[model samples]
Target: KLDMRRTLSEAINIQVPYNFERVMYLLSGGQNQTEAMLKMEQTQVITLSKDLHAKLQDWVSTYRVEDSEMLGTVQNLWGCHKYLSDPHTAVGVNAAQKFLHGTQRPCGAVICLATAHACKFEDAIRKALGSKFWDGTVLNDPKLMPPTAGSLQKLPEISRGTFREGEDWTQRLREVIEGRYPEATLVTPHLGTLWFSNQAMAMLLGITTAVCFAAILSKFARRSKR
Candidate 1:
């Protein structure tokens, strides 16, 4: 069960082929959720450092990584970082420490946050991480919540149009078929004659459809004579 929350933004979508967990974090103390929501939206594939990967490997070897409790903690990084106290960096914290086995330095941390729409996920962030300090917390206010029916319907269609425009299957198929038939070579009488002779030879050997008719005719003639 993967929960995908879409934010409404006008940024270019970067679609990648990978599977991972999505951690939805609500930032408290009135911090702008647009940045947090954008961070969530920008996520496609998270690359782990070699050290991080090795640490994960070590943990997997020692503990059963498939344990349900372990998997849940691994999946919700952003949430875990928020609830847990951090002694360093203040603003940025690594939430994957429990599952990860390595000495911690916040090096090689290049985090990018993007969205299809920064505005859409505003409400979700406020609910999860309260907004009392971030510009008077529009989260609980009815005005801040998006109208359910209108924006949801419009987004999918817009996304589909952009996807189709970028890479069209029909056009690619057409090109493939056209390339194969470039010369427009025809099967002339010579080719037809060769095919016909081969078919005739097959028929004589009783390997064609005529064999069934011949057997039926021979049986009928014998019955008539009898």
Candidate 2:
């Protein structure tokens, strides 16, 4: 009983139950930030000094006040409720509840925008929201096609060459052959929908990438020739 209690307490120590600072920080940002928003989310929990309390409070009070449109955008985006969530989502919920009184109708849902993968805050989520709050699908990459028998058949046909020793790919092939392919090989494909646009800005980025890549490749070739 003592050991179990100690373990539970250790778990609870890392879990952020209700952090006013975090809630304040999330709500202080842009009014409406989408999943594609490139802003570096300040997630590191900060314990404010006594002197900074008034300053922080002032910041929160004025946060997005100058940008009412952004405030409305964020509020509208987060108006719904969905049970699946994370800390940032919890912070949003906390904000909406405190400010918006949560959803009004019985049919309303709580839509949560999970800011980070659940594993990063699993202990915290489990402690504060309970373990069942986590669904096994948090980190799943939906972009990847599930392995099919057709894929397996094509794999053998695509590579009939015998595995060579002393190479990582060869070793991986050996593992696959030996039926020992580790879960570490599980790859998550990227969904590259996050993009910043504005035709002029995009053209600049394209030109920049081209110039950089050209310079890099030129240097690589020169080094190889030497």
Candidate maximizing lDDT? 2
Tens digits of per-residue lDDT, candidate 1, 29-64, equal: 232333433344576334554754665554332222
lDDT of 2 by residue, 1-226 (tens): 1121222112233323434434544654522222112222234334444645664664443111112232333334334432334344455544445445434322234454646433445454444544443333322322211235225323422222223334464344444544453222212122212222234333544677799999799667755654
Q: What's the count of clashing pairs in each model shown?
A: 8, 8
Roughly what TM-score does model 2 have, to 2 decimal places?
0.23
Model 1: lDDT equals: 0.33
Alpha carbon deviation, residue 29, candidate 1 (Å): 46
| Residue 157 shift from truth in candidate 2, angstroms | 36
RMSD to truth, every model: 27.2, 17.0
Taking all chains together, the TM-score of candidate 1 against the true structure is 0.19
User: How far in Å is the alpha carbon of 214 misplaced in model 2?
Assistant: 27
